[model samples]
Target: MKDFLTLRLYARVARLGSISAAARECGLSQSQASRIVADLEDGLGARLLSRTTRAVVPTEAGAEFLARAEAILDAIEDARNVVREGEDLQGLVRISMPSTMGYLEVIPRLTGFTELHPALRLQILLEDQRQDLVRDAVDVAIRLGTLSDASATAQKITTIPRVILASRRYLDKAGEPITPADLTHHRIIGGPSGVAAWAFEREGEKVAVDLQPHISVNDNEGAVVAAIAGMGICSTPCRRPRPEMLDGSLVPLLTDWARPPVEVHAYFPLGRQTRIAARSLVAYLKAGFGEPV
Candidate 1:
């Protein structure tokens, strides 16, 4: 009989589209994972994955096998749950979210969660870049912007308002702009898109401004630091840096002119059977974070 563990590993590799990522998830070395997959292909006499420098994609046979593999894993979990029904919630629940949000929002409240489920293990991965739910083995994810993946199920956590901000020193130095048009003249600290266009609305009227910032940073924290250092003004989600605002390190700008709110969502992998522990945690986050949908 084929080893069920090896089959589970193969399913994870196909889902994540990276041997290294799957290796990390399965607690195996990258070389070992690669060799195992190669052995499976040889045994079946079919190529399972097309590997490139950037990513690994499943072949037709591999894709077909993946669906069945997932089903088998799900069935196995269901069986295990039936056996462990009387015990406390115990197992790992991996989560991914934006680094800044994790620090400002989730991390502070993590102890409360751990206290509720002492036997459960929480693995939180903080990253600003997007992550694949299956590939990364993340049971749940907190996303700030639009979700393009149709394969995942999402629940709205709250709507985050996008707002412009500046340090008092920077505002004093450059003078605060009264209108969106005046932002063009000041030094702007920006992100990857780098001084791109921003939209503002008030009283049912919208205006777009093409801003050219003096400094460009690829990280959210970096932009916040730059703005606080009086480098320039910054645009960020309103929920962040509450302490900074309270302590007078950062100040809001253009409050009367409204910007569109960005939706915050909690997404789980599609088709995979979610654990009772994971479902409970998601519910806790929804209630704790903001206004729920």
Candidate 2:
């Protein structure tokens, strides 16, 4: 019989795109994980992954095999669960979500979840970047904003208003703009798409204003810090507003003219048999966020 442990190691490594990361998750040495993957590749007479200094991407063949491998693994686990504990299931469920949200929201509620499912183990990957649920062996992903991809299933969890904000010190020194058009006159802290063109509604009419920022950043969190430090105005999802919003450090600028709310989603691959632990967690998240359908 094929070694199930070796197959699982291969799956984890492929999902993570790094031997070291898989090793850390599995509690094995990096070299050991590497050897196991190499052995699997040799036994199959196929090269499953293309490796580089920066990333490990699966070959077309590897991607196809990965799907089958996951099914096989799940079936095996199902059999084991049926034989051992009847309907009760127990195993590791790996999940990923945005770093800030996971830290602020999900991590705190995990204690109650663990208490309910004493036999299950949970592994969480906290990052700002989107993770491939199938490729990364991630069962679910919590994200904010619209999901353009039609292949996956996205469940809207909550809608949060988008707010434009700046530090009190910045507003005091630069003088707050009374209108959206005045934003072009001051420095704007921005990320990714940069200071988004202001879009608002007034008197039941749509209005749009272009914003010109002096500085640009690639990450929103960094921009939030810069905004809090009194650098410039920033646009961020209201759910992830800077901590200083509550304190005197940062304050909302265009509250009346705020952009439309953005939706938070819990995304996962459709049609797969979700593990019990993952289902429980998803239910908890849906309840906690109370997102409109």
Candidate 3:
């Protein structure tokens, strides 16, 4: 088999077009580079280069061999990078999260982390569907609500208080509902799980109401937008509180009757060795969103 060092020196010499120039690029003396090339040619039993006083040029066989040598060196370098990235804290971490969380929470904090770790890279995958960690090869996933699986390890990052909201325009056009009973007559936007019938507690008593929605969406973010566009009232988590609520676009309808808070979590496979890049990213998120428990 051809030696990697010899092949590298041959490629460098071909690129620089001179032994002396290749020597500088390879951090070797000109004589050392020349000898390496000669050794390579001897190993292959072919004259790889034709040298003149002014310049060195590749022979026909040398040109064909140089192409192969360049490819080999490139592959070796790529393999090295993959191994280094896997072993150290300095590589890419693939992470996935819902669109709203990615846009409103994760993306903002990632900017600072990226600046701090120059070699670390983030591959963010945003989707409304719950990601399968092992199947998708994701390093981490941020999810909301109580985790159903007992096997996967999770850290509670934050809690989002649920709120009831409606656009001012919608309320003005269709009239506001004062009580849970009044919601039946008004249009409401529900999410993928449909209009969840929440039981609210007041004065130490629980009251259950089945919600009816005019429009139902697969994602909470979509429901928020629909509610903002004067579609209908929506019961959503505070993490994606209506922008209108902040800027006077939307207003709370029934504050006292809102459901209990929901929790957001960062989940990963149990007992897996957490990569440094993934750990750093999680730490940054916890600092911004509150520490993981």
RMSD each, Å: 4.2, 4.1, 13.5
- Scored by CA lDDT, what does every candidate get? 0.80, 0.74, 0.74
lDDT of 2 by residue, 1-293 (tens): 35878778778877888889888888899999888888888989999888999977779988787778878887777665556442345787788877756766678767766776677778898877766677667777877777664546877877767788888999999998877778888888776444367677656767677877766776566777789888899876656545588886888876667576767787776646666566667887778665321
The 10-residue segment of model 1 with minimum total lDDT is: 78-87
| Candidate 1 C-alpha lDDT tens digits along 1-293 | 25677887898888787899889988999999999999999999999899999989999998888878877766665565556664556666888988877876777867767887688788899978878787666888888767776868988877777778889888888898999999988998886434388889999999999987788886667788889898999887766545778798788888899987777788888878776666777777777776321
Q: State each candidate's clash count.
A: 1, 1, 1
Model 2 misses residue 261 by how many Å?
1.1
Best by lDDT: 1
List TM-scores for all candidates, in order: 0.75, 0.80, 0.64
Report the C-alpha lDDT of model 3 over 1-293, residue by residue, as the tens digit. 34877787787677566899778856799888888888888989999899999878889999889877766654564454556553434545778888877877778767767777677667798978886664344668888777675545787777877788888899899998877778888887997556468557666767777876779998878988899899998877776544578898889877777577777888875434445566667877888776222
* CA shift of 279, model 3, Å: 2.7
Cα deviation in Å at residue 175, candidate 3?
Answer: 1.8
The predicted structure with the larger TM-score, 1 or 2, is 2
RMSD of 1: 4.2
